[model samples]
Target: MAQQATPVRTARLGRALGPEPTAVSGAVLLLPAGEEISARRPSPLLATASVRALGRRLSRTGREDGLVAHVVHYRYRGWNGPEAHLAADADWAVEEVVRRYGDVTVCLVGVGMGGRAALRTAGHEAVNSVVALAPWLPEEDVAASPEPVKQLAGRRVLLVHGTNDERSDPELSFRLAARAKKANRDVCRFEVHTDGHGLRQYRDEVIALTEDFVMGAVFGRALSRPVQDALAAPPPLGLRMPLAAGFGRSLRH
Candidate 1:
């Protein structure tokens, strides 16, 4: 007899910050990065720290909008090949949010490998939008199938990549964004020049862009000129729109 595959355990939703569940008008599920291959149960993912910090910032930004933020703690520590355990964790998180909040809109925000998970899970009914920061997309080849973009339809999507990223290739994200845009015109990408996979150099600017996109998607607010332009512009130009310095500061006015 063949050995039975081990069933994955349920993912946990980290304590949220912001409005109470009963009062939340919108929610953001934050996903964290992980390794390429590992099945070890994640006692505590280091990547969760940064994403939690981001959630706190977003929670504050969307306080007036009644947006609550939750971090997803995956059942496993890695993407784990085609199983895509991270994406499954994200899906569970979305479902839990829906069960708790009932019809409230949701925005998925993730970084690195977690970004890939957010994009993969955006097809969920509760997810109105997704923000992928330095998403790790597999290179297309005979051995590796390309990530599907059809799932992104009817959902607003934003991909941010650092041009100087030493880990995940920025070009790969550009290609994915181009494909996703064709599938859903709402999809757009931004390039942070000279930064790495972490996008730390333009952290504030990236966060600002994310906040604007998430809030607009959740509350039907008007998007900034740059985002609107990027979404309306054609290929290459839209996929490679530069994230300018002081971009965050500019949003204040």
Candidate 2:
């Protein structure tokens, strides 16, 4: 007899960031929706289960209880694009989500190269929080990609990596976090089992940690109910144009 598939868990929540039409006011977390390829496939680090578990935990914090969470995926490519391309693309997605859902909180979770892209995008004006799992940063000894570490100065950043990453040096993320802390930024680090680079081994812990970080950053106790209500309301229709276009253009400039 064939074995039954493991049932995947899922969670949904609301957005709490701004008052806009497309803002995603809710979130969903569950197992990724696609077939699993070989271990070497370059998939996004934050899998479906990660999103669901994280969303559930965030709901408990009373901050993102109703926010809608959706699985987010970005195109993969070589990192030789313009300096602002990655950031712009990230901002555009955030805007698109807001335009569709209405002022909402956004949590971008990434691993490996995706983590690097998430860091680059975190500093954008539109991003709310960033969680990077086993992220890779450009090495100084090699031709370096544009450094996005500076943009992380004022943002909330979470870096999770294994000590035994062979594909990319985990120390790179540590050094990046150290630099961010040196600049007085809000950054957190989590070191998981030192046996692998991807987060498959420590999924639960990583999801819980990510949920806590997002709640703390996006819904700090200081946020007032009026702000929440305002975000829930509709946003001006055309005001978002420049923001979207500006971000798109930044990628090519």
Maximum-TM-score candidate? 1
TM-score, structure 1 vs. true: 0.93
| Model 2 / residue 108 / CA error / Å | 2.1
lDDT (Cα atoms) of all candidates against the true structure: 0.88, 0.50
Residues 1-253, candidate 2, lDDT per residue (tens digit)?
Answer: 9999965422222342222224334432221222112222224553334344554445544333455554444332333445333334455566666667566666666656557767776665656667777776667554655355777766766677776778767777766776666663456665665546656666655555555455555655332222233223232211111111111122110
Give the top-scoring candidate (lDDT). Answer: 1
Backbone clashes per model, in order? 0, 37
Model 2 CA deviation exceeding 4 Å by range: 1-64, 77-88, 142-146, 221-253
- Global CA lDDT computed for model 1: 0.88
Assess candidate 2 and give its lDDT: 0.50
Model 1 regions lying over 4 Å from their true place: 1-8, 19-22, 43-45
Error of 2 at 71 (Å): 2.4
For 1-253, candidate 1 gives per-residue lDDT tens digits of 9999988577999888655544888999999988788878776657587687788888987777778999999988899988999998999999999898888899999999999999999888888899999998887786866888888999999999999998999898898898888878898999999999998999999988998888788988778989999989999898899998988686752
